[model samples]
Target chain A: MNMTFFQKFFLFFSLAIVCAGCGTDETMESQSSLDINPLSAKPSLFDQSPSNMAKESLMEYEEITGIKAVNSDKEMIIAVQIKHMKRFFMAKHRKAWQKEMEKQFPGWKVELSTDRKIYLELDKLEEKINKDTLSKDELKKEMKHIIKLSKEQT
Target chain B: MIFFWAFVVGGIICVIGQLMFDVFKLSPAHTLTILVVFGAILDGLGLYEPLIDFAGAGATVPITSFGNALVHGALQEADKHGIIGVVTGMFEVTSAGISAAIIFGVIGSLLFKPKG
Candidate 1:
């Protein structure tokens, strides 16, 4: 297209701003598997009697695309994938699901997040659990690490 | 993924604007007004939110976001305080962008000479 030098400069400047705002840690090449089975067969990490209530409650939320959860003795941590558009209201959804999960699984401190990074990490942990690769102690350590990461503020 | 989507969507929007200016011979002012109105209409139809979700700041940084923000702000405030909120809330989310544009336009006019 024929354009003045100023026009070209303006177009590039705007595109640069758009790209800068879109930067994230995620790669376009990788697909997240965490959403495939949000509640994988209760791995050894969850020694308690299994409950479908958590899965059923999670499924009720129309915006959720995927889920991964693991629990230690007193704490249950969950990472969820939300439909991109609905993410604008993440705080509301996070609060709603947190409340629902708490009600479903009483006597446990529940932690819920929609962060993609957390979902990826949990997916890896779940993979290890399925393969019988992670020890109970290592599993606890990993859970603690993931939980800390979730609490981190950017 | 967000980066890719944002670039693609923002690029397409910019392309459409460029086409309007070059092919239709529309003034910059007219093109911008039309885009903003289009955004507002989309917001009214509940379609802009999904676009924002898909494109992130790509959708937000464009001029169309001005329209979306105007309507969104008005609706939110109207829900809380009724009709008067429409006037007050219209500029709530868009104030920074609008104020910056005016201030910069003044400074630019003072600093630069027109080409034609």
Candidate 2:
């Protein structure tokens, strides 16, 4: 049927609202009987000693810079504050590094922020360094080098 | 097509907002404040989460999302700091989004002269 722009707009809007409202009900109903377990029950591979060591290194770096470091199995996020710089500086630096990373790795991302935070995806590191193929000592040395560089940057 | 629907939903919301402004003879700023407060109330009642799930970006890319952000931030802060949360919670959660909006809005306003 032919309709004015406003009429069409209102029709679509009302439909969307109704659909959204109905979808919630559907989700609740579907989830009610489902035996879904939270992922917390199973400890991740990164919960092991090497990952702990990596996290410790990040923590040490943060302690020195008066910043904070958050390490997860997948990524490491570091935050710090520097004097006499605008807040946007962090964003700019992050953007620059991200661009550089994109150029080097094509699809991989390394996020840096003006907040004195840097994030490196562990999966990307594993892929780049062939961590699975490396010997244990080689892996340790590589991780140490990475930790050193991360600390030096801040 | 998903992005298209998102824009359409956002545009429709804006239209309704404009209509409300005209019919009630309300200032845009006042309308915005009221809408945000209404969104906060809905979020407090735990109704907004469903809307977010359904509408995806449609619900999130609106000014109402800002209200949701405020409510969520406030609640999280309250959880952490108790009564002092009233002052700190909203700012902590929503500061990044709000600050960015303000900075961009200011930049846009300065760069583009709007005819009254």
Candidate 3:
């Protein structure tokens, strides 16, 4: 009573699939068991921590191209500095990074700068914003100026 | 446990991509497109949501999820606006990603000099 090789193979394959389907080890926590809808399950960027945002922005910079984000500082604007990759000299590469930054942080200025002059201003502005010395209107005025400057160079 | 499944599932997906690139000799672009289209088709059939729930980022991080997001957006819109939803829905949910890619891609082309 010899079985054909194909029949034997099919039998083993079916059994393997059945075994895989029947496993019941649910190792994940019950956090998933909570009643979470798909709509609400989507990730949101609003009201997130600033430091984490900085970290992720740097990560995104590195991911987009091979270039590292040399620096990141979040103030009125989210300033992310990319290393002076030769690619940055490419017009398309700079635009791509610029668009990439804006996409991540909409309505918030994410200036992608390689210029030393603008990079210095970005850090100084962040320092002022952190100090909280300026009044609300004054802060608003400073932000406008910073935006203008960022646009002018980068 | 969640992380474990996420790792396993994500690893499997990546392995498939690697195999296609290495063994099958498929280009990276073709592999990515195929995965995305496959995801979209699965989403249309209502099969992908369960996999997403089970694998989380394992499922979502892959290029396939881009197609899933596109189909998901369309399906959601179809419920609201009838046939017109078919067209508008494609971009509604995934515009953030698609727009960024397109805008950034164009900018990169314009700003940088390709290696000569």
Off by over 4 Å in 3: A1-154, B103-116
Docking class of 1: incorrect
DockQ (Cα-based) for each candidate: 0.13, 0.03, 0.05
lDDT of 2 at A53: 36
* Model 1 C-alpha lDDT per residue in residues B32-53, reported as the tens digit of each score: 9999999999989887876786
Better of 2 and 3 by TM-score: 2
Which is the leading candidate under TM-score? 1
The docking category that best describes candidate 2 is incorrect
Model 1, runs deviating above 4 Å: A1-29, A35-79, A82-154, B103-116
lDDT of 2 by residue, B4-81 (tens): 446556777788789879999899899888878877888898766555544447767777877887888788778888
Query: Candidate 3: TM-score?
Result: 0.41
A7-60: candidate 3 lDDT, tens digit per residue: 999899687555544442331222223211111111221122443344454454
Error of 1 at B100 (Å): 2.4
Residue-wise lDDT of candidate 1 within A1-154, one digit each (tens)?
Answer: 5578889999998888666555542432123322455334545556623223465568667677777777667777788887655666776788888898888788888888887899899888877766667677888899899999998731
Pairwise DockQ winner, candidates 2 and 3 = 3
Interface RMSD values for all candidates: 6.8, 16.9, 17.8
TM-score of each: 0.55, 0.42, 0.41
Reference-based lDDT, each prediction? 0.77, 0.52, 0.58
**TM-score for candidate 1:** 0.55
Candidates sorted by lDDT, descending order? Answer: 1, 3, 2
